[model samples]
Target: MTKELETKGAAIQGADAGKYELSEEQKAHQQERILKQVAKELQLPLTKVKASVSLLDEGNTIPFIARYRKEMTGELDETQLRDIEERLQYLRNLEDRKLEVIRLIDEQGKLTDELRVAIEQAVKLQEVEDLYRPYRQKRKTRASVAKERGLEPLAIWIMTQPRQGSLEQEAAKYMDEDKQVHTSEDAVQGAMDIIAENLADDAKIRAWVRKYTQDQGIIATEAKDSEQESVYEMYYSYQEPVRKLPPHRTLAINRGEREEVLKVRLEVPAERIHDYIAKQIVKGESIVKSTLLLVIEDAYKRLIAPSIEREVRGELTEKAEEHAIRIFAENLRNLLLQAPIKGQVVLGVDPAFRTGCKLAIVDETGKMLYIDVVYPTPPNNKVAEAEAKVKAAIEKYGVQLIVIGNGTASRETEQFIADLIAKLKGRGLRYLIVNEAGASVYSASKLAQEEFPKLDVAERSAISIARRLQDPLAELVKIEPKAIGVGQYQHDVAQKHLDESLKAVVESAVNHVGVDLNTASPSLLSYVSGINGTIAKNIVKYREENGKFKDRKQLQKVPRLGAKTFEQCVGFMRISEGVSPLDNTPIHPESYEVVDRLFRELRLELDQLGSKGLKDKLQHADAEALATKLNVGVPTLRDILDSLQKPGRDPREELPLPIFRTDVLQIEDLTPGMQLQGTVRNVIDFGAFVDIGIKNDGLVHISQLSDTFVKHPMDVVSVGDTVTAWVLNVDLKKGRVGLTMKNPNKKQ
Candidate 1:
């Protein structure tokens, strides 16, 4: 370490430094050390990481880097690159604080080697205070003002054990009527107050107490009598150990305290803490020890206790917020990955009033087949005509499913479909009520307008409803994920953080399901590996201009799509009838040579190996055969074989189908204790909203989600999940339905 670093370390150790305090220099050096450590962890060359850090500190966005800096970061993915960016910002903030602290200490003219080292090594604000304790300003303190009266020698003599046998006799030598020390008892009492105040402000003692209180404190709160019947009634008599409180309970308690519904207290056993402080300060003397103990007690009661309590509460709140965010992130990942119900011919209905009902027919693959309008509701007064028109279209197009947008006149439209299905009971068909949260937004979108310029906005909405059922991942990706309504306090949370988190969810979902290179829209394709917006457009243009790509090699011809992009993304882009079988599986195209060698060694052709039986054979194949023939590990070869057997099978299909209802029920019709099957529409931190065929959704709070305590609503129910919940409370006036997931008959 340099002299500056050594000096900082000493300051941190609380060693007495000479008149020149080294605080300022130490803090600056400490910041430099943190930056170096962060840069090294990111595995970037020092220069490159430092340059990026400087740019970020000046305020640049992550999207700017992911798009523009291909060569700068060795093309790091968005996630890894953003992690480095966040850490850089944090370190820079720490550096700015260090500079400010150092400047303040230097101005005090108390800079020393030990003080400098302490400032440099300080990891937290608390540590900084402990080091600065000895030098901090004192107000009209008893000890300092007493010293001004020329009582230092007497105070020191008493503290050091006076040479005289009696402290009173020694104290009388310094006492005078002008100094206001008339009696020995009065003089001793005044001296004891000075000692007590000094002991209370001791930096080392305060630091140890702060740490102990944080580890052992319990935040206790009781409801005020006036607010005893409020929403926070349960928390009126609440007291929970800081470390043991669950995330939801912590948030609830804090919210209660903030609203003044509870009187909160942060308590710790102070007796044990006082004993520890006494050991450090009042070493061994009967008279001095008695005075020191009295001083320590006064100091704690007057100052230290209150400060420590506030700090502990702040730390607990921060910890709770962190845990809540982590839970939100996990739930979002699973909700986004819910299965896409594929390959169904659907009749989409966007119900309306003056415009009647806009109907659009889409093929099994989501291609628009036809569009029309029918008045199925009031003002038309011709229900017969509307019914005939819908039946004829369904028959003509062979529509296997009916998707009604949950918007205006949706209940009436749903009734029409249910009646139609009842009349044609022998016809194999199903109907679903699709959430239209962002359907209108998507219809007005530039991308949607470009895809359907000739169709009216109403018809575009119908098409969206149909497509959402066919592939929820692809359709939902067109709109911002936040607009999809699956987060808790999303708007209140950091906007940039929410966007990044949701984007990760979308990307992970898209890749998990895989995509068809030729048929996928550019919006969907952009999420695929190696395929950005420009290249995705190019791939679409190439397909439209020259027909479908016959093999993976043809992808190289797309504008601006290079060899490196192909290597990262080709295996994830599936082709239904490509020239090679591996083109349809997740096994990268580069691994084709290895598969071919394995095939030859087994005396089998690629066509014969496509059978399901071949998967079993490959699963049990010897490790030595794989190693000798393919020059790869058995594990790698086995993974490749498994991918080949499935050949683009979506992982999401393993989940249950989204629930679709035929009849709509109102809040008034729902009674307390009534059980109903509902589909989960969206998940938030506090609860999950279930669509029970009513225009409004019912809420199942985290506590009501299960008999056992749920950390999050998604722990038991996910987006599109069908759950059986009982109505716990129904407020018709407010149009609110409170539900419970736990079975009512089950024993507690």
Candidate 2:
């Protein structure tokens, strides 16, 4: 399997060259295979897969189909829709290739009924290639040269396994000086070469060997330079069964090998493979048995082993990369959806030392109210002066939250802010450390500069910090998704695959929360369903020139946003202060007739959509019968009912609120078994990094994630999760703290 994953970590293998070559009739047949494979793999209904695939092929975006066309897909969510799309592409490519290969083989006059059946039934690209191995065009190997010398007949004759004939003497009949067969020995050797190559190309044997290798192989590594002082020291003398190696370890070994820090190889029981091949090809005892035995040894060691090893290694790396990218995508989605500390004036501080901490104060609406710099840390150590400036801004803007970036000198700045806030203890102010992973990158980005042309990089970062506290999804969209640094070995994975998955995650989050049509930035608008970057820019321009949008229909007037784009994106774009209250809800324009009917038939008015009277009526309504009566899908009607209850609701509010701090704690304050609350900063395959009001985040290893069996850290925690963890170990020298989520009070 090629295992080329992109969005949603597609397990789509093979180059889809045949997708363009397939005829409509061929594609129609391929559709059945695709649907069945997808349904079986995802355990979704086959009918649902067919409908989802049809919607996808008609150019509908995933978020659009997931939200608006729920009935057609049996209420499959975005994730299920994307998976069907992934498998559909893979199976279509597989079918198209099967047809293309059949055409290629038939054109060469080698097609047969058995071969056709084998090709058609092949489930994976690897199987198809194996079946096509012998017929595939060759690069002048020993077999090809043997055919040139008329030794193929001799090789074919040897296959009958003459019970009592001298193999070399039988070969002597074909010896000719013109063909370079100087002796019977030379002719026999050439015949054996042909037999060896043919044995290596046998599809059935190749499949068996591939499976046996993986089941019995050991992946071993050793240091290339013993004294290199590398981070892969643990892998210096490592040995793991190929079947049991985890994704992270596989990626690590690949990186180590790439950096030339280690020499890695797969160790398998070669004798067993040789014996297996001998049994499959040698047949009964005969004069040719000894020669065929030699052929098996040559075919395996010289041809099959090397190629299988490379394929297995590629598969391992691909699987690992897919897992890592998925982790990154999930973490990023959770990070973006982090509950915003809304309705409060926030003071954002981009912590620094010599350059001074940059400060930005944003109001409840995220409008920048003030920007300044302070030098309360190191070098100048102007503590009192910095404190006065911050105090003036806080008192002037009535700031309720102090958001400090966890960067250089962040600990010192937090201490200073803690001291200052403590002095005004009754002001009802709180402070918290914000992850600054992508702040610097976003600050220097072209988008940031365009958004705030007058501000310097650090000053812009301060504003971003403040805005992130106000609304993470809106502010985070300004930066590239992968730059957020949420996963392990992100840089080592396939860059294109990682980019596609992360972008999808961002889109999913943006749509889930819904976008405000009037006040959204161009950066945020670009991720809304069908809106491209160009169309997003056009939207912002139109809004700036014409003022706020009164209705969602006004989006049609924007340049380059045609009817199709509008249809795909309108439901995700909400107008909170629009002329029509229906526009504020997720109810699609096409569903307006249904909503009007729901209200009219239920003896309700549009103004009373979310009122307790209507909500109660909706709560007890027969949704199934009502959906049929309204001529809409039950899922869509339910969604409309939901949207009507709480129009323009920000879904982030439902999640647990972010943890705020009133004081700072140094590493010295942590003790073993001390329970503390913290926010999960980043989650990887093995553990989660949590910010517990300290400089470095503490780690909750998968082992300590729970008292019961725990598989992955993500299963227990995600980024922005508020968890209570007990300190297990604190190493002041290394500035590391180990934590466990298991309650110490629970009896084992």
Candidate 3:
């Protein structure tokens, strides 16, 4: 080695004397290059990918774009959009570290052309370390001590194989007593150890090992022999390759290791690894090749092996988390998109005993009509009075359906309604047990209090129950989805992640079912496109001050609701008396000109296009002719025509009626294997929860949801879906109701 090289290496070990920094511009350039490569890998348009990155950098939520900005994103779904967002964050972080590594090497005056090229091409931190391995500082090991003792020349001679004598004969020259040079064998062995340690710590060797292990590593765990009946029992005899292991199994194994219930180790086939490392070391038969081989073996044993094991395990765990989160987000979306049961005159009952059942009636629009109290269950002993009160309310309010809250004494209240129905032999009267998980929370909320100041807290709860049945999307938005009690281990997951995911579900559902601009509450309006809480409140206040909105143009008159907000949200906000009928449909105002031209081409007025016969004729019309005339697609033409036919049709009206039972009050009344009609309240990764007219919600675990294996519960049932479930087990003390959907014939 040269004297200059020695000095630079010393400076690197001492620090302060050698350190460099890159400019911000240099870092940004590197980031841009990396992003371009990622875009290529994903096969996304560069402009679109960059736009998504820019949005993420500014902390814009994904749900906002997926629902409102169809034109800007080319209508990317939530999954594709989120993938881009996650990748951008990772690439940015990698670029930052690259800049730091470059500066450190330049300061040490050790930045060679080869090193620079390696660092520039490195895509991960492990790759960067591999390039830096030869330059890093080291302690006074046997290799450095040998070099100091003047034995390095002999070692180098052997490594080079430069037409010399045998290795021992060559080493004799450096074996002077004054230098404390030992036997040729001892000197050569010490030299080999130094080389081995150096190779082991080399960044290149570590990176290679990591890649190999990630592809071939097997994670095995054995129980400690003490906790056989513990949480880790399933994983006690587990051994599986990292890549092949299922996500749930990975999480279970990791949790077991965290609790110290299992001893875990990652293993790879030895012969294959040894052969691969040998080839890298012995590229050709030079004297250095022999030393490099020893180094490779030493590195694997001492440094590379252990580090690679941990990295492989960590990567596996991260993959598991990503998979689990994706499943959860999907299920949440389906649950939120569940069809709402609209336009029903509902009688909401918040069932109780000592406090008596609180009943409130709501009209088809979810506005509270009347409030009353009745002791339907024990202690009051007023069954006849309760029956009379219910009948009178139903008759007076012209209630079509009864919505009983799924809370305390719910089944008893359901039975009371059943008896009242039989006594009156009423027509068009059906009672539903609503999933009232978060009703109590909503009743005591500040928003509820502000909306109904004159009514008691119990009465507000009844109103919430009625509103849920009338428009689930609007009312459910007031409470947190996790608190709505539909998910599994919701509390155990990351709170911010869960909240953001669930919020996206709610927003998507709200937009899917267009809101009534005239009658929607501020809370419901807030979820609409371009309308925030402040704007929603302003809209409601303006409507109250003035009259109902007669057209989309009136939205701009609301305070703080500008033209841009109106443009984005107006199409989603339906007006029955709008000047342009298209405003009531999901078709954007930007497409109104095209729609009007189509109407003119058909030789029909806009009003004449509202019938199914006219729509069918328009849909069958040639797309090529329309494209030639209006410069639009057959698809776009058809879409526009359909929107015109049924302007402001409530998509919720197409869904099945929510079935609620007026019998089977308690767990004691439920028998194992008994089939019952129930409504699915929430869906999670593990299972779906069904409200079977009982205070306790029944769990339909994913395994029981289908005869075949179900990866997720949402695949079977969604929120607000009426399903038939069989009672598997009923534990009243624990308040557990286990239900199953495994049998197709199980439903009543």
Against the true structure, whose lDDT is highest? 2
What is the lDDT of every predicted structure here? 0.73, 0.88, 0.73
The weakest ten consecutive residues by lDDT in model 1 span 1-10
lDDT of 1 by residue, 1-748 (tens): 1112223432222234333343778656755676676767776666566556554554433443443343455455556666676665555454444444555577687777776777766655556655665566778776676676566676666667433377777667767778777777667666766666566667677788888887788878787785457878877777778777766676777787777788888788989987887787665765566666776787787777887777666666655655555555555566556677777789999998667999999998889999999987876746788889889998999988899998988877887878888777777777888787688888988989999999878999999989888888888888777666555544434456567667766765676677888788998888775567899999999999999877988999988988767765676688878888778877767778888887787666778646767766776777567776667755556657678667667888888887765444667788888999888877766888998877678999888888777875666777778899999998888788898988997877
TM-score of each: 0.66, 0.93, 0.73
Q: How many residue pairs clash per model?
A: 19, 0, 9
Shift in Å, residue 355, candidate 3: 5.6
- lDDT score, candidate 3, position 206: 69
Native-referenced Cα lDDT, model 2: 0.88
Report the C-alpha lDDT of model 3 over 540-645, residue by residue, as the tens digit: 9999999888877788889998876776687678877667676678776767889778878877777765677777777677766886799875555555666776
Which parts of model 3 are misplaced by more than 4 Å?
1-115, 123-203, 211-241, 252-313, 351-358, 371-392, 407-424, 440-446, 452-459, 557-564, 633-635, 665-748
Against the true structure, candidate 1 has what lDDT? 0.73
Q: How far off is residue 329 in model 2, in Å?
A: 1.7
Task: Give per-residue CA lDDT, model 2, range 105-131, as digits (tens).
Answer: 777789999999999898888888888
Model 3 clashing-pair count: 9
